[model samples]
Target: MRLVIARCSVDYAGRLTAHLPSAPRLILIKADGSVSIHADDRAYKPLNWMSPPCTLKEGDGDVWTVVNKAGEKLIITMEEVLHDSSHELGVDPGLIKDGVEAHLQELLADRIETLGDGWTLIRREYPTAIGPVDILCRDADGGTVAVELKRRGEIDGVEQLTRYLELLNRDPHLAPVKGIFAAQEIKPQARVLATDRGIGCVVLDYDALRGIEDDKLRLF
Candidate 1:
């Protein structure tokens, strides 16, 4: 990874035109041939970025231009470079999620019939263009079901499940897929949203799901 700190201005020319005036900023040229300009805000989101499958061209002086196959251009003009350095960070091992959500998904998949009588799992992490649905299943009548599992349910979680439904319902084999929002605790607003969208909401008992039959699950 190459990191450059510079006093630079940036311009983006493509679907829309954007510009960032001269200021002290960090420019990142990653090993994947992606380039991004960052300000000291927004946590991890870069102020501007050109993703991979793009080309970076450094011209004479301090100007750099990046272009993509779609003909989009990200132009970085540096008046002065404060620091320039590169580092070789080896391949990452990927994220190892701790035992909550992952564990819940596994538990639910193993005991799929807990959802309802005759309910069966089709796939966990069912693939789609937008992203994977946490659980793909079949209901009592063999209708397709897509479940989005979360540690805590919120309106955002409902919205995520809604997207998966839209994509899954497009496939002929899964055209009539319905969604279930499963979480430990679902917010009232999220429950309402899921209801409004005709999506089922299931409040899971973590302990019971871990195989203790002391408390029961609720479906709304």
Candidate 2:
């Protein structure tokens, strides 16, 4: 059977362009408005995201079952389905989430310096008693900014950032610092808490961060 695949360039917020294919199976977007569809059962065949190819089949429940080259099975929900299929095989979702979060942190560190003439990213792996904060930045105004990011969870991580804030608040050396929590989703409770505390937050959906669907991830 011959599949007619057409490529369309999708410009994502001017940051990236992905080539997407017309077919539903193994659709990947390229920057040149080109799309490629994989004709095989390998989920990541087009992107070559995984070696040995991963297979997707229906599982016991509605969730999809993913089997790697080693015959390891992973059940994934619709939300994580794409990440599971595209990334390294046989890896847990949490681990993948962590990696994504880390990558975001690094990107933020690189871009924060260009947020304006004065704003600058201070450092990564900012140490604290609980654990090392992801990114600590100094804004153009000289106020310290504390940022924490998570891949899977909602703003529940705000609770954890609250601790970092307390520590920084106690230490006068940290400057007039502000807190920012970055995540894929922000829960209502966590949002309220952050608002009440006058903290800033940014939320991005998975697709938006990936710049796949027009950078539609709204962050506030």
Candidate 3:
């Protein structure tokens, strides 16, 4: 990871044109080749960013250019650099993840019945060509359900779940696979989109799920 705090101005040219006036900001360059400019506010959200699969080149006198395959270009001109540092974060162990979302997935998988009566999890991290589905389950009628879990459900989550359903349903055994978008909090727009596509939306309760799991463990 590379961090640079500098007084800079940024301009993005592509589908839309945007310019950030000269100001002091933080520039983050990640190992994945992604670059983002951030102000002190807005939490972790970047003011501007170029996602991975892009290239960055440094020019003379504090100027940098980043370009993507789509011909998008982000030009950054730095007036002065206040701080500059880089760190090598080695290969990460798989165990480190978003605690809440990971735990929610585990709890839901262990207690698949929470989804519906007689519903049982077939597997967690069910593999698909593009990516893994959070949970695969068999419903009461023995129909397959592909679930996508998220910390905050948004339109993109619904879209992702829809893509998984499209792929899973292609399999002979899992044909007609239903989709369920489960999240701690779901946006109204996302719920509307899911409903229109016939995808089920579930608002998960972390503490409630943990309590249910505890009760089951005690019984066993």
Candidate 4:
């Protein structure tokens, strides 16, 4: 990750024309070729950002241009750079990867009934051409459901579930497989997208899931 604090102005030329007046702001350049401009406030959300799969070119002096595949261009003119530094964040295995999310998957598989009455898990990491579906289950009516699990559900997660459903539904045995996007927290946009595409969104309760596991252990 590279961070640059500078007095800069920005102009974006694309579907719509937008401009940021000359001011002191923070510029973030990621390893994936994404660039974002941010003001001092607004927490984590950048004021403007170009996602990855783009190109960046540094021009003579303090000018930089970023362009994406869609022909969108972001021109940044820096009057003065206050500070510039880059840091190696190294590989991120992801948060709560081992304990939280993985355990959630295990608990959900054991307590498939939480999804619906008579729902039973067929398998975890169900295979698909693209990738593995988090869980494959059979509902009360014996219909197959392909579930995608996430720590925090976003639009991309919904898209992934959609893709798995598309592929799984092609199989005769899993024909018409339904999709469920399960996450501890789901964004409003993601929920809307899932509903629009006839997918179900499940907001998981991590603590409750763990408690269920504990209760079963106690009974045993």
Candidate 5:
């Protein structure tokens, strides 16, 4: 990973035009040839980025250009580079969910009908071009369904599920696949985003699903 802190301005030209005036910000370039600009806020989302399958060119006079296949361009013009450095972050060991999440996935896979009557489990960790989906199943109507489990669901989880659905739907066999974002507790924002994307949300009751009834949750 290459991290550079610089006082630079950026302009993105594509479906829309945006300009960020000169200011000190973090510039990140990854080994994958992806580059992103970040400010102090919005810790997760970058101000602008060019995802790989793109090309980056460093030009003299302190400027960097990133262009993608669609001709969209991100131009970074530097005024003063405060810091620039690079590091080799070796290949990452894929993410491991906590015990609760893992157990939830197992329980849900066993009780696939919890999501809907007659829902049948197709497979767990269903392989895809991008990554493995948590759980793949078929609804009562025989329609394909993709279930993504999260201990505490957030917007990023929804986005991940969205990507899986996009790829899953591309296969003729699963051409009309739907998605269910299941989590122990879902944030309001995440729920709204999922609904906007036409993805259903299920607030998981971990203990209940595991067949361990908790007295507090009982309404008697």
Candidate 6:
């Protein structure tokens, strides 16, 4: 599958965030309204790796398909995947989205506590009053953080986080310390922005959050 490029920015930290589609095309339906994902050559080539009606797995993910050799037809799809990475990674886009949210939750719970003991963390979905902040954290220290979730794609900068930062600055309870813009995938410009403004930003890859053993999901 061909990967689509999105615009992004970067910083000295090598952190990044791409300007995602207002609503990512994580899901794709064929002319028949059947579901499909955008997979790279790696994902597409093994369509027949299994039997006609078989279950295939990838990167701890699953791919399901059925073949009707009687009609020279094959039907391939994910078992329970969702999210937009279907186009790029060829996995269920929905699964990618869910993974992103899960990762965010895990990261927040495990790390937010490291910032301080008395700190209180919060979680918010995309598109808050300021914009889409996948995870928004506000601590007892009056610090706030904004996270943009990305499953996979072209890494870009956090333009939305900047807007969130502006909003955080307005909040009396969260204005003094600073805002943290976090993401699993980010662009170069985003890191630069955070550095220049003296704000904190972090970028994590899939491997980074794996095996993290936190059962509690932070409110943010």
lDDT string for model 6 (77-192, tens) is 33433332323333322223475567655666556654457666576553435235556665665556555554431213344455555555666865553555556555565667
Tens digits of per-residue lDDT for model 4 on 1-220? 9999999999999878999999999999987577999998988767777765589999998789999877999999999999999999876543345677888999899999999999988999886655678899999999999988998998778867876776787799788799999999999989998998799989999898887634654755
- Candidate 1 clashing pairs, residues 3+ apart or interchain: none
Q: Which stretches of candidate 1 lie over 4 Å from their true place?
A: 1-97, 212-220
* Candidate 1 global CA lDDT score: 0.87
What TM-score would each prediction reach against the true structure? Answer: 0.55, 0.47, 0.57, 0.56, 0.69, 0.41
lDDT of 4: 0.86
lDDT, candidate 5, 133-185, per-residue tens: 99999999999999999999898798788778877888998879999999999
In order, the Cα lDDT scores of the candidates are 0.87, 0.55, 0.88, 0.86, 0.89, 0.43
Off by over 4 Å in 4: 1-97, 213-220
In terms of lDDT, the best-performing candidate is 5
Which candidate number would show the highest TM-score if scored against the true structure? 5
Candidate order by TM-score, decreasing, is 5, 3, 4, 1, 2, 6
Writing each residue's lDDT as its tens digit, candidate 2 over 1-220 gives 1222322221111122333333333343332122334545744434322112356565554444445444544332332223212232232222223567777766667656433467787788787654677788887789898987776434447756766776777678885678987777777767776887687777755554455333336663
- Candidate 1, residue 70: Cα displacement in angstroms equals 31
Count clashes in each candidate, considering only residues at least 3 apart in sequence or on different chains. Answer: 0, 10, 0, 0, 0, 33
Q: Is candidate 3 or candidate 4 better by TM-score?
A: 3
Candidate 1: tens digits of C-alpha lDDT, residues 31-128: 76678899998777678887655899999987899997679999999899999999998775433546899999999998898899999889988877
Model 3: residues >4 Å from true position, as ranges? Answer: 94-100, 107-148, 154-182, 187-220
